[model samples]
Every structure is written in C-alpha cells, then in structure tokens.
Target: MDTQHDNALTHALAAIPGPVPPSGVLHVVIPHTSRFTVVGNHLAQHAELSLIAIGIAVYIQSLPTGTEVGIKALTARFPEGEVKIARALRELEAHGYLRRTRVRLTKGRVATRTVFCNQPGAVLRGAVVGAVPVVGPAVRSTTPAPTLVREHIHVPEPEPVAVPTAVPEEPRPVPEPVPVREAAHPPVRLPLRTAPTQPRRPLPHPRALTPELRQAASALLADLRRHAEELVLSEEAVEELVPGVAAWLERDATTDAIRRALTADLPKPLKHPARLLRHRLTALLPPPLPGIHDLAQPRRTPVTPFQTCDGCERAFRSHDPGHCRDCRAQYWEAA
Candidate 1:
C-alpha cells in the first residue's frame, strides 16, 4: 500500500504543469450594485435539476413580488415552448424549490399562486439563508490545483522544573456589573383578518346599459387577450367585467377607444386580468353625451302666426287677419 501511495504521489508531482495558461472562460465579475437577486448553489447546481429548470428558477426569483408565474405566462415570456417550460416547472416543484397552489378567492374563483424558495433545504430546516452563493455562470477549468510540500524537524526534550511550594497568590479585582435587560413579554396574538367591506368598485346603473351596448362591451372584454395575452380573462371573470365595460360604452365610448384605454401601457406581469379592467373601465369612463337633462334647453325665438286676408282671402303675416299685401295696396288706393 505504501509503495502504491508513493508511486501515485510521484506521478501527480511529475504531471503538474510549471507554466499556467489562461483559461477559455474568464470571469470579470463586477458585484451587482442594485436590483439583484441571491440564489443558492445547492439549487443552482442541483444534481437532478435540468438547465431549463435552473434558468426558470433564477428568472422567477428576479421578478417582483405578486408577479404572475403561471406555466402559460412563463412559456410566453421565455423562448421555450409550453411543454418544456411545464416540465421544468414540475422539476422545480419536485425538488422543493417551487410550490404551486390553487387558491380560492373571495368569490367562487380559483387562482394559481406560485411560491419560490431560494434555499429549499434551509427552508425545510426552518432557518434563514446564511451563506448561499449568488447566481453566476459556472465554468469548468482544466487547470489543476497546486501541490504543497512540508519539511519535518526534531529536537531533544528538556528536563521539567519543579514549582516553588510557597508561591503567593495575587488578588484580582471584580469586573463592573452590566445592567441586565428586562424580561421578555409573551408573543402577541394577531387578530384574524376579515374580508374587505368594499371590494367592488361603484359602477354605472345597469338600467342605463342597452342590449347592444352590453353585447359590444362583452365582446370587447373577451377580445382583450388578442391585444395583450396577460389580459385573458376566464368566462366568469369576463362576465363580471362586462358591466364595467358597458358603463364605459354607455357614455359614448367606442370599442376602439376603450380598447386603447385598457390595453395601452399595461403593467408588466399582470396578476389579475379582471381587476385591472374593472379599474380602467371605472376610472376612464367618459362623461355621458350632452343630453337635454344634463344641459339647459335652448330658448326658442317667438314665431308670428299667419292670418287670412279679409278682402282678398289670401294668407299674409300679421297680428290679425287682413287683406294680402297686394290687396292691401289696392284697398288703400280705393280708400
């Protein structure tokens, strides 16, 4: 065994290169200054996680809170297709790095909620992330680690000396006392949160909406997905949002105008399609067209009534019935 160990060590020493060449991959790492996310090496270099899964995890971690992370949303955002993204998401979930749940909302609606863990193991152990490495591209280098050699030296032992029997002990001063902190209080119990008293926004009266306007509004809401895929609403959500869109139309808002208003400059990673439309509809509602009830009626000029001539029996404009202008002239001449 000793001979084998010596032979292996001699081979390793002889194989060490004297001149080190530059590696193909170089890291000019500049520490991130702002808007950065911390990822764990365990998850990044997972023994079982695929490359797609790691990339997906990093992307999700970098997003702001409450960002939509549905499989469809991710597939649309990334170059990967639906099947591959779905598979990667499942891989992440299997290894405890991702959690997906179907949350029941206040209404009878179910929403998909995604949660990401930067350090799954630490989370499982009920501890905070202490020393997880930041995310970076891993490069394999061909350079080998340098070997070290140590020299050994021996010296004679010296005779021990005996201690004096009557060595006097020195007195030590006590340290100043530190003020102790007060006793800790019991943890406060948080009160249960109640549902919102006013969840729905005030909408225009339903009676004001005509059948044609409702149909147009419903069609507009359903077609929003074409302009912005994130605005895709479920049937129930579309139904709930139709009235609000109808309110916009009741005020002389055209579908094109409303579409531009709702779809223009939409927020990134839209979490709630219905909620955003409801807000835009209510907030951007145009004032109803000028109606007689809304505006003062115009005053009409007084109009004179036509009268029949007494002598000529011809119709003429006068305060009372009289001869026609030609008949009046003739009558005047006769008088």
Candidate 2:
C-alpha cells in the first residue's frame, strides 16, 4: 500500500507545469511603514477631498524621487486635461498632501520642485525640528544620510574689563519767530457764462413730383384709407404705396384703371389688401412694346461696370456702387 501511494504522488508531481522564467524587469518594493501607504489610506477615508484630488495625490506619491511632476506631465499620464489636473493639484495642496516651491538653478535659471508629504502636518513639523530645512530636489540615495547643519550658532563670551562713567551734555537756547511776507500780485477771478441753445431744423421733404402724378398718388392713398380696416395702411405703408402708384401712372395707367384693377372681383371680406394689390399690379400690366428707334438699331448686351468694395477693397462686377455681398451682410448685422 505504501509503494502504491508513492507512485501516485510521483505521477501527480510530474503532471504539474514548470515555473516561469524571470523577465529581468526591475520592481520597486513599498514598505508597510512608507509615507505613501499612510497618505493613501488617509485620502481613501477623507470626506473633503474629491475622487480626482485623491487620485492625483496617490499618483504624485507613487512617482519616483526627483521625477518632474508638472501639469503637462500629469495630464499626459491621466485622461484629464491640464486645467483639471492643475485644479486637482491645488486641492491636494489645500489638504496638506503636496507643496511646490520655486528653486533657483546653478545656471542662473529658475525651476519648480514639488514636495510630497505622506504624514500629517503636525508629524512632519516635529520631524524637522532643530534641523535646517532641505533645499534641493528630493532624491533617493544608497549612501548614508548627511548630518543637518543648524541655523543657530554659539558665540564665545567676551572677556570682563573695567569701564569709565559718561558725562551729561548741556541744552541749546530757542530762536525768535520771523514773520512771512505776502505775495505782491493776487490771482484774478473769471466770470462763468451759460451756453446758448439752438433750435432744431425740420427734416427735408422727399423729391418733388409732377402735379398730375401727385394727384393720382393721393387719390390711390385716399381710396386705400377709406378701406383702412381691410387695408391696414399706416402712414409708412401709404408712403410705400405712392411709389408703386407713380410707376403705374408712368405706364399711362389712370388712377381709375388702378382702382378698378385692385378692387374688382373681391371676396366679401378683403382679408389681405397687400397681397391682392401686389398680384394685380404685377399680372395686369400690359406687355411693353419695342420703340421705333430701338427696333431700328442692333440689340446690344448691357455691360456691367467693375466696382471696388468699400469694406474688402476687392473688385467685383456690379451695377450699384457699394460693398460686396459678404461685407453688406456684415454691415447690416452691425446696424
């Protein structure tokens, strides 16, 4: 029975796989009493510090000694942006987990060094008591630590010697007062005056029109005013309609012709006069006939003049003189 048991044990040991070979990768050993461990626990239990602040503190503590821990570097390690990383660093500093001091370099330049503390502020203060503060960047060392140089120095007591007594000095007499002379000339005073007000000038009237055309325009406006409830014509609307009425008169259409065309075949209630007028004026106009002189001459295409834009200074083909389309849109927006 013992021999059978030994054979079974040997078979089980043979069936197991061999151990993995070392990859030569170096590893850092974190002791249980390290400041990083203590700070990490404190951060985990902290109620004031946010998750981002806690994570940033842990990342700073885990970095190798003397490593550059700038905002750019922190942003690259984490998914957050530079602003967020900077805010998190500030939060860490507020909680006494980190500090940064500007250090002067040997080459007449300046740099910032970040110091991380794992222990609380009280504990850290006690540890550095009676010792000069560390100035350079913090780094790990294999050699023994150096002794701290104290800031206070002891001085030897002076030898005891005999001294003579001092004498008191006499007081000086006061001088007589002198009167000051007045100025020969005095400043002159100027009288204040009120500004005169000017009367405001009246606005100029629109361009002059012929009596016949003006009478026709007025008759059309009066007809629309009579049906004001349906027309909804304000003073501005009447002014706008005068131009269209003048155009009809130039085509030899009488006021009576326009009134009949605009008011004929109307619905019981004229809900929209503007739409009806626009349609009649556009559709009822007779087709233009060619003039005798125009018919005799050869037809020629009108040439578009090149104009420079006031805003962009670029040349473009246009009949009207002003800014280009893009500049005009921008100007209207500003207005």
Candidate 3:
C-alpha cells in the first residue's frame, strides 16, 4: 500500500509542468528500501525526532561518503541555527541512524567521521557478526542446524596412532672454570669547599620630576580645579597625571591647548574628574611626528595609520593619524 502511494506521488510530481533545468539542480537519490525502513521505524515517529531532525538525517545521508559534516556546514546548507543542527545530529545518533567514530590521523592529529546507517540496530549488529570469521566455519555451520542433527552427524572418530618410548643414556664428564683479574690501582677522593655569600644592595629611586614638568602639572591641575571644584587630586594622582601631560607637551600640545581640551564642556558637579581628564587627554592627543626615516625618504604615498578621527570618532586610515582627509579639510576651512 505504501509502495502504491509512493508511486502515485511520483507520477503526480512528474505530471507537473516546467521540469527543472539540468544545469544547477542537485539530484539526491533516496533508496526505496531506505524509504520503508525510515518511515516504519519507531524512532522516526518519536516526538523528539521532528521533521527537522529527519530532514537533517536525509541530508547527511545524501552527502558523499567521507564528506565533511560540521555545524557550520550544516547551518550554511540548511536554514537553521548551529544549536538546532547540533541537537538534530544528537537525535540522529540516539536513534542509531548516525554514528560518529573518532579516528586518529597522520601527524598525531584526530578527527571524527560520521557514519550513516539506514538499517535498524538489530539488523546492523547481525550483519557485523556475520561479516567477522571469528568462529570457525565448522562451528558456524553446526550452530545453525538442530541439536539432534548436530549430535548424530559427529559419530565418526579417528584411531589413535602408535606411541614410541625413549631409552636411557650414560652421563657426560664436566668442564673446568676460568680465572678472574683485579684492578692495579685504587681510586682517589677529592675534598669539598663552601662558597662565600655577598651582601645585597637597595634599588635606586626613579628620576625626580623636572622643574618644567612640575610647572606644567601645576598649571593643568589649577585649570582642572578652577573649572571643576569637585575634583580633588591627591599627590599620587598628580604624580600620575604629570608624566602623561609632560609627554603630551613633548608631542607639541601647548599648555593652553591641553587646558582647553580638559576644560571643554565641563559638567556641573563633576563626580569623576580623574577619569574624565584622563579620557580627554588621551582622546584629544595629536599624532606623533614622522620618524627620521620617514622624513628622509618619504614614499610617494605614505602608509596611513589606523586611528579614530577626532572630529567624527569613526575609524579610518590617514597619513595625518588623528584626522581623516574629510575632517582635516573641514578643520582648515574653519580656521
């Protein structure tokens, strides 16, 4: 009845107009034997094995043998998430439609190979047993017959061969032993001595802040405190801020420019001055000057560095480093 129904469905599909083009269409062959086995299996009717799981199994079976099967590949071929494909593969394994065996490859590498079996578990097991020749052909041949037939068929026995006894012989004479030799001189011993230890010295302090650096730091702090009185910078905080500000000066940021950047659009009742100041100084820093090599032999076109434009905050490459071409032109126009 199922075969007739399948035949009718095939005919109905064939009668439809507009046959698919042969150029890009994929032909997947599903064996008639597999159709019955898969449809009639109890696992196929299971609620956990939904249509999605069945579809995934059929797709895997359709793939060429030894073809790579992975979550990423499945997701690309099927309109499903990686998680769903993984779950479907697990369901197929549970139902014995799929088996994954881990194999070690050359170069000490390992990979998993998926095995698709359309037959039921019991039939598969029986086929495996039948393929192996572990038991002798005689034993296998006898086990399939009835017990009475097996007993009656083994009546003939081979006659015992005549045995030969050994006679006693006379004893032989023993041989003499060889002599041993000793070393001529005795071994000598050496005396051991203890090594002396040296005293440890204290590490030197880091270089002190120069007077110019101190002035810049004081000016920066004064500007910050004036604009935002809520800011309370301890000596440690000042020490930390000094080096960074000094480095900015070395990079050509004037005292006034640094002051403007930190004080721009000050928030009333500032809650976190150190964090805010750190972000402004770091974000508004200018690009480093070109190196000596770059200046001496400039390329026809300089290799642009990756940085966020100060004006737009969008990442772009530019020879100017901090500003992209569009924003740089805008700045010059405004000036």
Candidate 4:
C-alpha cells in the first residue's frame, strides 16, 4: 500500500466538502511528535543512496539505540531479503552514515555491532567544514596537513602570512558501542530454522531403527512399487528412508495409511521417485498416538431441539413459538 504525508494542498481540498478532487496523492499523515528520529536531508535525500538504503536508514534511526540493525535483523523487519538489505547497509556505510564492526566477546562469542551517524560531513573526510572548527580529533599525519603547516612556517616570505588557526572540525564521532542480540525463534510449535540455507541431511536414516521396525518399514516401501510402478525405490533409497517410515509405525500409523500417503495423487512424469517418497515420509509422518486415557473423545455434533411452527406445525429449529417465514409470507400475499 502507498502512503503520503499531509500538506497544504490536502488541507485546502478538505475545506471544499464535495466529492474529493482528483490528484496524484491522498495524504493520511499525522506529524510524529513522539517515537520519531531526526534525519538530516544529506542522508535522507542522498543522490548516491538507493531507495532501500534511504528507507533502512530511516528505520534504523527510528529504532532505539541498541536495537538490531544487522542484515538478519533488518531482513526480518523488511521484505527486501538478505541480499538487498546487505547491499543497502553497504551503501549506508560507504556514505559514513552507518558502520558495522565484528567484535569478539567473552567465551568465544563474536558479534557485529551497528552504528548510525546523522551528519557525517566532509569535515571528518579531512576537508574543513566551511569556516567553523568542528572539534574532531586531528588526523594531521594522514592528510600531510601538519607537515604542510610546518613547511609553510619555514618558507622565506617577505610578508607575514596569517594562516587561519581555526580548524573547522567537529569531534570525530566514534561509532556507538552496542551489544548484539541474537534473533529469537520458538520451538517445535515452530520450526527451529525458518529458512535452511543448505538442504538438511535426510532424516535419521535406517541404522538407528530397530531390526523389526526396519524390516516392516522396508516391506511397506517395497510394496509401494506393486501398487504403482512409478513409486519404485532403489535398495539404497529404501535403506535410507527405513527410519522415516519406522517413525510412522512407532506413531501407530498403519502400513496402508503410509502407502496411501506416499502413492496417492502421483504427479505427472513422477520423475524423482526416491525423493518424492522421502518428502512424504518426513512431511506426512503421523504424530505419536496418545494413551487410551488421553485419547480425544469422538466429537458429536449438537442436534438442535426441533420446534413446531405455529402456522403449519412443521418442524423447525427456533426457540420461539412463531409462524414460519413461508407461512407469514403467504398470509401477507393473501391480504
């Protein structure tokens, strides 16, 4: 959805109270008195920065100082994904408005700290900020500035040269120190990894399963070929997935159910047979059945108490002793 901030034209439109006039924008903005961050036009309107970078800078500035602004954190907050967010962050860093540094902490912990600068102008880049001394730590050696001053002092000059002593530099704004917080993910109620970078190792293979369970699981898999030729699995594939099918058996899911889960609705071409079986085995594996005492009672739908309509004595489900709608309509037509 698009959003716009209100301005003079929007206020003028409201005063004429007819159908709204056509314009390119409709404003719905309320000025932010609280929960707002100050952003300089230099960063916000930067010619070199991307739209993503500009928006991210605004978001980072609005967050509390220690809030996570790392690639992962921003990726979560925005839909632009890791690559774009990382690129935008690089843009911000290159412009001197953002910085990321990896710090090693106690107990083998390493963290990346992110900092945002509001106005990182050319003064910090060694060029003086117009006429004012901007109080930054003098990095004289890096620029040959102090050496040039000394050379100028030694020059044989007839007239006294008054080099302006005012060093127009602000205090070199150090990157803010911040502790990194890891992103939180909930348990089996949710997936441990929301997005896996690498394909997960196929579920605990047949080796850990008992001989009896493995034998049964293998039989079920081998039987799938008889039901559908396309459902064929290699001996190695069967061995690999024996544990997964065994998991279903352990959950008290029947062999027939497992077969149905695997073979039903086979797609056209049915190309990677073993891969299909593996996916079904993992995804459709039933949860363990509860003990008899904990088993859910069969749900019974409530039967509405049948009522006799006053006009027709017809059975209906209302509590009031009133004529049915059809009979009422008939009487109105007669009148």
lDDT of each: 0.68, 0.60, 0.59, 0.67
Candidates 3 and 4 compared by TM-score, better number:
4
lDDT of 3 by residue, 75-182 (tens): 988789997788778767666567677889999999876655543443344444443222111332322221111101221123455658867667555432222221
Indicate which candidate wins on lDDT.
1
Instruction: Give the best candidate by TM-score.
Output: 1
TM-score of each prediction:
0.32, 0.30, 0.28, 0.32
Candidate 1, superposed: residue stretches over 4 Å from native: 1-24, 127-335
lDDT by residue for model 2 (69-164), tens: 788877888899987787777776666667778889998999886666653433344344432333323233332222211111111223455557
lDDT of 1 by residue, 1-335 (tens): 99999997777655655643566633334578666666668767866778998998888767655567787788789889998788888887777667777889987999776666665554333322132322222222232111110110111122355756886789667543333332322332334679768766675545567788778878888898898998988999877887888777777777889899999988888898778877887777787788776688778998888999888687778887767889878878999
Q: Where is model 2 more than 4 Å wrong at Cα?
A: 1-40, 124-335
Which pairs clash in model 2?
A: none
When summed lDDT is taken over every stretch of 10 residues in candidate 4, the lowest stretch is: 146-155
Which residue ranges in model 4 land beyond 4 Å of their true spot? 1-31, 122-335
- In angstroms, how far off is 238's CA in candidate 4? 56
Best first by TM-score, ranked: 1, 4, 2, 3
- Model 3, residue 295: what's the lDDT? 77
- Model 4 C-alpha RMSD vs. true structure (Å) is 25.5
